[model samples]
Target: MKRELVRNREVGIKSGRSASYYFALWSISAKLVMDFFVPARDLNFFVFNGLLVALFLLLRPRLYLGRRGVALFVVASTFFAALALKDGGNSIIFKIASLPVLVVVFFSIGRGLSEAAVKRLFKILFVEFIVCFLLNYVLSVATGLIRSREFWNFEHANLLGSYVLVMLVPTSYLLYQLSNSKGRIIGFVLVLMAYLSTSTGAFLLSLSVFFKAKNLAFKNIMIILLSIIFVIIAGLALLSIADPMTYDKIAAPFKLINSGGWDRLVGEARNGGGITYLAADQQGSFTWRAYAYLVYGFFIAGETWDRFIFGNGVGGYEIVWGGAMPHNDFILILTDFGFLFFIVWVSFCGWLLVKVWREYPQWFAVVVAFIFRLLCENNIYSYYVASIGCVIFSLIFGAITRASRERGAVRAQASRAVA
Candidate 1:
């Protein structure tokens, strides 16, 4: 592996110099808005996984995996393929097939993706964000109404939220690294957009960009004042509705908060309550998600031994659950890939988490946000989600590794001069 790394370095195959690298980045970024224009989900699948297949055959980037890594990959892929044969659909099959290609591409990128490349990727995303925001606003004004959850340029509200999250975290981290004041301003715009999109998770995570602001006191005051005003306006709007029963829906979340939190939720699940009480209008999103976790848990527990060990296969969750998905990525993995593959998945993610902690601690918050998104959303099958995330973090790993080596060399030179 070391020899392979050295060989790549000797050949000077920089990521920025490669056309395929840019194509990968562009395809990833383009997927964010492609849904708005095309509205065909399969196109996204093709543009992303198809490109990975092409890259793997053409570029043939080295895997850069250790023995353990290879073992984990082979095991996981075998199970994924097996499950696909048993119960998986084309989406799962293609997604599974793309795993090896993703491995090669991410590994090649993990070797290095230049800062210039990173900047270009985010710049494209930022421009798209601005354009989408403006278009949504103009359309809303012209229509004289905005939906409770605006989809912006995407086909779904949550997809817009996902895109915002993908953009907000890493871009904020990069801006903060440069001590750019402009980040806060841009973050405020994104925060507002998130709120308008009605995605609570994205709205909260977008605030991280302002966490280290120099004028924290002033920002807090302004934020509080704005929030209060927004609440008042929203309350008035609700009150204007002739439906007096709206209060019951408005108070649903408060009821959940006052109820016993985890204990009650788990207890309900154990009692085979299902999600009858946690259904849409009865409770908030958190309570609904809690029920979802328990439902997936019971399903996994009830699986036959063979299915339990190897999983029902990719897309298994929807197939078994009557087209319902486990929105939580961790649960999705357990249910789709089964118990054995989940172990490997956790190990790989743990290794990556440790690497980030050691090499680029500054991006820890961004990683946390990404993890939160994974927990709250179904992302394993989405090509853009995988590409945007892995590419950015790979670049981070490369940047930090190179800088550390350079610093070590400088320290060695200083010590030699002293001697």
Candidate 2:
């Protein structure tokens, strides 16, 4: 009777743990799909903020800032936040609050997640992301809501790119770690999907998946070549679907090469005339982005000392620039947090980069992809990108840290046996 009672207790404990685990996963997964329901350009801030609060209360994870150095960071960030409040003040307090909330949540994931759990989360997320993407595209086309073939049922085209990039980059590292045939196939599909999204930044960053060291080996090289071939075919297929004139315009370069129009091609390249004419919508065009960057850069350079170091205060940029983000993470950080806090942020990211690069190259790739994406998109505050990012990084880093400790202990045992 005692044995049976003990067995029941064990089963109950396991079931409770699983319930908690799945709840955590569901909370994070819900962020990715939540915005799809809302038709506006803005995020679902209410739901996102509520979910974060609920997770914090349920998990109650301790915030471990790791060493005295982080104290300075905390102080700097607090100072900036105060400055923000004193200045113009941001309407969205969650933007500022989400950072520390994500930090605490990272500890929660780190404590509970194993390698298998991380992989399971990735698989669930990947499947859902792909399915939703297809549905969004189909629905957009059928409903005649298309904007330059890039926009979909999601928020924006760039956001769509960001979504896929988030999934593709991390999974690239995961696939590299596994090196299974099926995993490689999935990786290729992700690459193609990124290409189809037409978010140039996301597609470019997603290529980091193929940067695995051993992929240069002959067998892996063949796989990459095949993937490239498929990418070309897919691009052509998409253009053809857009209608005949558009298809011919896209394929004109190849036809020009066949006709040996080298002079014409050279002249067009020199003048930046040919493909530049085929740019996306006005907002997605390179000129618009370059102008935005210049304006932000000039503002940062010309700001007063106090404003530069302490920032114009929370929603200062939005107020000054007609409610548009800086669109660059570094600029957003520098402008919002000031130079002092920006230094701390850079230092923290640099430390993580070096740590992961030395100990875990797979995670390193994902981190690089993330940093690269930040160059074009300021998504650190968003629930979809930042929240999901915290879960992934925490799980991978935690599992690897435990594995490293286990390996060190095993080595010590072997050495003692030899003695």
Best by TM-score: 2
User: Tens digits of per-residue lDDT for model 1 on 1-419?
Assistant: 99996776544444354443454465555655564445566676677667666766766544456687678678767755665666544565655555554654565554544455555555666777678666766675565445554443454566567666766655664576444566666777777877666566677666655544333356765985697578656864675474334444445555665664556677877665655665454565655666777878877888899988877666678755566666788888888778887887788778867765665555655666777788887776665555555555554454455556667899999999999
Give Cα distance to truth, residue 277, candidate 2, Å: 14
> Candidate 1, residue 45: CA error in Å?
2.7
The C-alpha local distance difference test score for the whole of candidate 2 amounts to 0.63
Residue pair clashes in candidate 1? none
Cα TM-score of candidate 1: 0.71
Query: Could you tell me which 10 consecutive residues in candidate 1 have the lowest summed lDDT?
Result: 242-251
lDDT of each residue in 277-312, candidate 2, tens digit only: 432322234434444566677678778999898776
Candidate 2 off by > 4 Å: 1-20, 39-44, 48-84, 87-89, 149-153, 177-179, 214-284, 319-324, 381-383
11 Cα displacement, candidate 2 (Å): 10
What TM-score quantifies how close candidate 2 is to the native fold?
0.72
